[model samples]
Target chain A: MSPLLEVRGIGKRFGSVVALAEVSTQVSAGTVTCVLGDNGAGKSTLIKILSGAHRHDGGEYLIDGDPVRLSSPRAALDLGIATVYQDLAMVPLMPVWRNFFLGSEPTKGRGPLRRLDVAHAKEVTRRELLDMGIRLRDPEQPVGTLSGGERQSVAIARAVHFGARVLILDEPTSALGVKQAGVVLRYIVRARQRGLGVIFITHNPHHAYPVGDRFLVLKRGRSIGEYGKADITVEELTRLMAGGAELEQLGHELAGYGDVTALDGPVKSEDEQP
Target chain B: MTVGQDAGGPVPAARVRGMLARPEIGALIGALVVFVFFASLSEVFRSPAGIANWLDPASTLGIMAVAVAALMIGGEFDLSAGVMTGSTAIVTGLVATRLGWNIWLAIGVSLLFAVLVGFLNGYLVMRTGLPSFIITLGSFLMLQGLNLGVTKLLTGTVLIRGLADVPGYHSASMVFASTVSVFGGAFRVSVLWWIGLTLLAVYVLRRTSFGNWVFSVGGDVRAARNVGVPVVRTKITLFVTTAVAAWLVGTITILRLTSIQANSGIGQELIYIVAAVIGGCLLTGGYGSAAGATLGALIFGMVSQGIVYVGWDADWFKFFLGAMLLVAVLTNQFVRRYAEEAKR
Candidate 1:
């Protein structure tokens, strides 16, 4: 089957600087496409282009093999594209149900007399979260009360509930601890299992390695490498991501010159260096 | 599940239980205390006649208070709202009495102007992305100038008069400002409008999709937009709604007195804002209630009228108002902190 979303030769520019240059990727249903990058590697720019926040200066975006233009975020949403940012994309003071039903709230009446059906919204919020295996302490509790990991889960579940076929998460686990990151990785897997195409953006290869089906590494706004899960081992991926030779040079520099005991251990192991 | 294992587990009934234990509780207590304080000070305050009297002012303030609270909860302010009333009233009076237009037609025209002003406020704020305080402050000054300059030019005086002689004036006045007998004493028709508007606002805020948007827009506009909420449109509509409320209040005031003063609604905007904040609306937006605003208005009315019944100098009203504002804001801040801490 064709992939859910396809980006071909997409490039974006901000004034004089090139934020992205000819980045291309494909996201398939039931798979996590990890876009790994360091800070300022144009991860945000790429996500914005994908989520319809910014238009690519040059590119072809296809949904089901038909070229499309997303003029705005609303346009992207209509096309079943949902992007969850690192902040969890929610109002802190609103109840979970209200946050869930914020944008596309269901209405009962036809026109001026139309009103929100709170009961229905609440029911759906509960059912949707439960279906995603996320149990909230109280649906009425403000989302601010939720932990960092739980908030990301809610945003993920929200995208799923809204019928998003492609889920683009922007550094979803960047601010989280090891355990919290694990929880989010679990949800990414869950979303993928439910047949939704997930684009997981993160800097940590360890966090992405477990659930990622395809890995695309970005360095300074360009795709440095793309590999399938079976082709790239965790150690190789980490070495490449950490800039293997540069890391070794830095380690060597940090070691006290020619002092065996001061160097802590071996300067270079046979298998460790490139 | 054991309490330890369920430490972060879903608390089945905790939401409602938590609500009762927090800021909502403080608001309820404050409302009751104000009610009791007024009731004990004045014998008439406990009677139907006193209820009608207090409710009259309460209703007028209630209508504006509710709208202001909604806007405040959405994280914006309409400084022009108070003077916009004067502007609308002057427009209606000048058109009906001086221009010889039908009273209803004049009212419609006046409302259109009010809507335009509201649109301008919303449009400018959104377009410029400035703090609404600065934008609405500019609007307030511009309208104040227009209200004074235009009324003076049209009427050759500071006040526009002769509205009582305009065609359909009596019926319009009866509908908009005349008294209705509720128990023994007559209650202002505006009071009925206020209560009806309050109910409508409550329904919109609590039970409707629009209410959800209001909360979301106020809570976090970027988040709301990211999730596909129409942030700009929601805010624009809110501004328009607030202006319309101002027009209604102006119509009631002018028709009741059969005259319009250029400065009639001057200085009332802050009171509406104060009432809204005291009623539990966050100045930063994202949390509030229309009923809370209405109750806040009631507190204002009770205090405003209660001072007179207790035989105190009316001059002290300003001092009382300042104190109420300070105390209410301080209380609201404490409650907000409590809510935030409780959420953690």
Candidate 2:
């Protein structure tokens, strides 16, 4: 099948500083394209370009094989490209339903007589959240009260319901704890299962390896490597991300803490074999 | 999703309960208490005549309060709103009574001027991104100066009179200022206008898509814009709406008195803001009600007029007002905090 989105030779610059250079990636429906990077690794710049908040200095972006220019976030949204940032893009004090329908409110009647369909909005919010396996204590409750994971889930559900073809999530699990991260990962999988292309951005290899079909590792504003699931192992990906020399040095430093008896026994052979 | 397996069930009623737990709930209760207190103290307080009397002031103030509340909820302030009324009234008076224009034509010209001032306010704020407080304060001072200087220059006096003699004044004044007899007592036409405007404002705030944008932009401008809201247009329109309300109030005041006083509405902007705040609007924006503002104006009218009915020293009214304002704001702050907390 054709890719849902494709970025060719994308580059971005701020003044004299190059934030991203020669970065290319493809996102396919029912697949997770995990973009892995540490802080200041050009992930934000790349995502901003993709979301149309910033224009790429050099690139051709294609949606379903059709080249398009997105001059604004609204343009991106109109093309069915939805981005859910870490802050979750919601008004904290507003009810879940209100926030869910914030920018694109449903109206009945016509012209000046048109009114917000509050009942329909609330029902749709509840239904959509439920469809995504999210349970709200109250649809009327302010979104700020939900846990970080739940908020991410709500945002994901909103994008999906709004007919987003590609969902770009920026560190949805970074602010969450272990169990919360697991919850969000589940939703990411759920989104993919529903045949939506998901770009799950994260730095943690273990987190990405579970749901990611392909991984693009970024470092210092450049893509260090791209790996398919069959081409890399979790340990090798982790070592590559941590820098092999640094990982080796850390292992040597901690080797003194191992039990001498176990280290000298069959465990040594098992380690050597791997 | 299976019916029994659905994790999303009916949300608890406690969300609204959380809102009720807010300090503003106390103010709401206090408002009720004050209403009952005044109603019980005087037989006239419960009468249609008394209601009309209080509602007349409430209507004028209500119109201003609703607009102020909308602006406040949008996270801005307009200090010139009071003096803007004087300016608009003077425009109507000069155009109709002095320049010999038809009353309707004068009103149209005056409304245009109001819209211009509103546009200036919105444009300056949006272009500069400055706090509206300072921008509108400048506007307030300029309009105040214009009201005094222009009126003195034209009429050789601080007051412009003889508006009653203008063509169409009789009919226009009747529509704008005269009362209709309801329940055997004349209720000021402005009172009906106030109620109607309040209802219209409520519909706009609660039912329209524009209302949603207002809340979102007021709540978080960055998020609202990211979500595709036309923040600039909404805010500019709000400023214009406020100016139009000021024009209406000015028309009623000038028509009723057949004269325009240079300093008539100079200090009243703060009162409109206070009534809005007391009614449940947040100073930081994104949360409030037009109905609440109307109710807040009613509370003010009751306290102001009720003091006289109970035969109390009128001097005490200011003290009472100050206490009410302080208590109401403090309570509303608590309500806002509680509501935010409950959402978390």
Candidate 3:
């Protein structure tokens, strides 16, 4: 099947600074496309461009093989592109149902008497989260009370429920604990199972390796490489993510002071040269 | 994490506790305590007549407080709200008495004036991205000066009169300022207006998409915009709501008294905010209730009139307002903490 979203050599330049250049990726429905990069690697810029926050300065962006121009976030949303930033786009003091249906609340009645259908919102919010395998004590509870991982899950479920064809999550697990990261990763898998193309952006290869069907690496506003699950292993992904030979050199430099074996990293010593 | 393990969901007892943890719960308790204290101290304090007396002040203030609470929840302030009352009344009285316009027509003109001022405040706040405090404070002072200067200029004095003899004055007064007897105790029609306004506000805040937008914009404007909420429109509407409320209070005061001073509603902005805070509104915004603000105004009415009914010095009213505000905010803090407390 054709990819739900495909960007070919897309570029964005802010005056003299090239924020992103020659970045390309494909997001296929029912699969996870992990965009892995460190800080300043243009991961944010790429996501912004893909999500229509900023107009790409160069190259082609396609949806279902049709070339299109996205000028705003709302335009992107109408095209079935949803981006979940670290903030999760939730009001902390608002109840789960309120946050869930915000900006698009379901309403009943008519004219001046029209209002949000509270019961319907609450029911759907609960059912949707349950479908994502998360059980909240009360959907009426303010979303701020939910753990970071749970909030991410809610955002993902909302995106899926809202009919997103491609979901872009910006570092959904970076601020979470191991177990929490595990929880969000599970939700990401659930989203993929729901037949949505998910762009899971993160710096952690370990978090990306298990769920990501395709991996695209970014470094300094450029696409370093793209690989399928069969083409790259976790160790190779991790090594490339950590700047490969530079990290191998740092590991050897610090090797004498610590038990490097206890590091449990798969970074191979063979990657380093004398 | 420990709490989410229950597949059966939270127990009824815990659920009840959760309800009690709300900020409004604190205001409700404070209101009840004040009612009892005043009732015990003075025989007339709890009487139907006494209730009428207190409800009079509360009715107008409550209307303003509820609107201010909505604005507060939307994360802004209208310091000029009080002065707008005086300014609007001046506009109405000037048009009716001086220009010989009908009272109702004068009121319509005043409403337009209030709306324009409100739009200006909101527009300036949005366009300049300044704190509403600074923007509205500027408006507050400007309106204050305009109230005194324009009233003096138009009428050659600080007060407007003869409204009682103006065209449509009697009917306008009957609707806006007349008294209705409830079981032999006369109450200002504003009390019913206050109730109706509170009900409408609570419905809008709790059951409408606009209410959800209010919370979102107040909670985090950037996040709200990212999610496609119309942040600017929501905030501007809030300011306009407060201004319209000021118009209501202005109409009530002028029609009821048959005259209005240039200084009417002066220095009452802080009182409206005080009532909101006492009713469980956060100064920082995004969390408040209309019912809470109504109760806050109720407490204000009780204390301001309760002191006089019990033969206490009216000078203590300000002191009581400050004290109650402090207590209510502290109580709200504790209650909110309890509400969000995770269980093992």
Candidate 4:
């Protein structure tokens, strides 16, 4: 089947600085595509393009195999592409229900008598979150009170509720603990099960390895490699994400002090020269 | 909304905690304490007559504070709000007394003037991306000069008078300045207006789509925009609301006294802000209530008058007000911290 979202050789430039270059990936419905990159790996720039905050200077951005140029974030959203940033777009001090329906809040009455339908909003918010398998004790509680994982889940569920066909999560687990990361990953799995296309952006191989059907590793402004789950193992994915040869050399350099076992991966053991 | 464990039933303790989480709880407690303390110390402080006197000042302050509180929650300030009152009054007085226009006509002209100034304030803030404090401060100073210069230029005096003799003055005054008899005490009509506006503000903030935009924009501008909230329009309306509030107070003042001094509302801007803060508005924005602001104004009225009723030096009023503000803010912060920690 044709991919829901396909970017071929997508690139962005900031004046003389090449922020991102020739990055290629595809997101299909009912699958998770993990974009793995370290800091300054053009991850943010790529997101900026895909989320329509900026336009790619070179390459094709296709929605359902049809090329299109997105004008703004609003346009991207209209096309059913939603980006849930790490910090999220939630007002922390606002109630969960309020945050859930902020821009598209439901109202009752007409003309000057129009007002937010509080009962309807609260009921829908509660029911929607419940449908996503996250049952909050009270929808009236400020979103700041929620755990990190819960907040991410809420954001994901919010995008889903807003009719998003493709959800791009920016570093969803970067600020979370192991258990919290696990919680978000479970939600990602649930999203996949719902037949939504998800683009999960993170630097953590361990977090992405189990959930990801396809892996796109970025180093600087270039794509290190893109591999399907059948083409690579977690160890190989981890090595590529960490700059495999550089990490292997660093492992030898720091081998005498502490255990280098953390970086020890399925790096080609026969490359003995460097 | 149930407030217990993930799968459990309701928790009574959570219900109490929820009540405390309201933005106005601290202000409510402070109001009760102030009432009791003053009532015990001075018999006149809690009397019908005394209540009437205090509520008058509170009524005016409440009007301005509620508007300022809304603007604050929308994530901005209007230092020009105080000067705006005087400016609009001067405009009304001049148009009527100098040009011999109808009193109602003068008021309409002043209302328009207020809206223009408000739009300018909102526009400059949005366009330049400058802090609103600086923008409004500039407007405040400019309006201050204009009020003085224009009055001196036309009237040859520092104040405008003879508004009472103007056509339609009597009826206009009746509407804006007349007293309402309540509990055998003649209360200023502004008191009714104050209550009405507060109730209206509360409804708007709690139940309207615009209110949601206010909170959303103030809480997180980037996020609000990301969600497609019309941020500029919302904030600009808030500014205009504040300016119109100033016009209302100004109209009340000039009609009641039949004159307005050059510096009638000078230095009163901070008081409105202080009232908002005491009433449980976060200086950071996105978390406040109009009812809280009204209570804040009421606290101001009671304390300012209660001290005099107790035969205290009026010189100490500012000091007392300052101390009250600090205590109120500290308590609010402490209670909020406690609530958040307890929730966790």
Candidate topping lDDT: 4
Q: Judge the docking of candidate 3 as incorrect, acceptable, medium or high.
A: acceptable
In order, the TM-score of chain B in each prediction is: 0.92, 0.93, 0.94, 0.94
Q: On residues B16-53, what C-alpha lDDT tens digit does candidate 4 reach at each position?
A: 75886688887788888989999999988778888999
TM-score of 1: 0.88
How would you encode candidate 3's per-residue C-alpha lDDT over B29-48 as one tens digit per residue? 88898899889999988878
TM-score of each: 0.88, 0.90, 0.92, 0.91
B1-344: candidate 2 lDDT, tens digit per residue: 11222345333644454655332354467668887998999988879888787777888998999999888877789999999889999999999978899999999999999999999998899889999999999999999999999999999999999988899998899899998988976799998898899899889987888988888888888888877789999998888889999999999999999998989899999999988888888889988878888888888888888888888998988898788789877877766665565211
- The fraction of correct interface contacts reproduced by each prediction comes to 0.48, 0.44, 0.48, 0.53
In model 1, state the lDDT of residue B281.
83
For candidate 3, list the clashing residue pairs, or say none. Answer: none
lDDT of 3: 0.89
TM-score of the first chain in candidate 1 relative to the native first chain: 0.87
Cα deviation at B127, candidate 4, in Å, is: 2.1
Model 2, residue A62: displacement in angstroms? 4.0
Better of 1 and 2 by TM-score: 2
- Model 2: how far is A134 from its true place, Å? 1.7
**Where does model 4 sit among the CAPRI classes?**
acceptable
Q: Tell me candidate 4's interface RMSD.
A: 3.3
Tens digits of per-residue lDDT for model 1 on B21-68? 233354566668867987897888778898888788888899999999
DockQ of each: 0.34, 0.31, 0.37, 0.38
How many clashes in each structure?
A: 1, 2, 0, 0
On the 0 to 100 scale, the lDDT of residue A114 in model 1 is 89
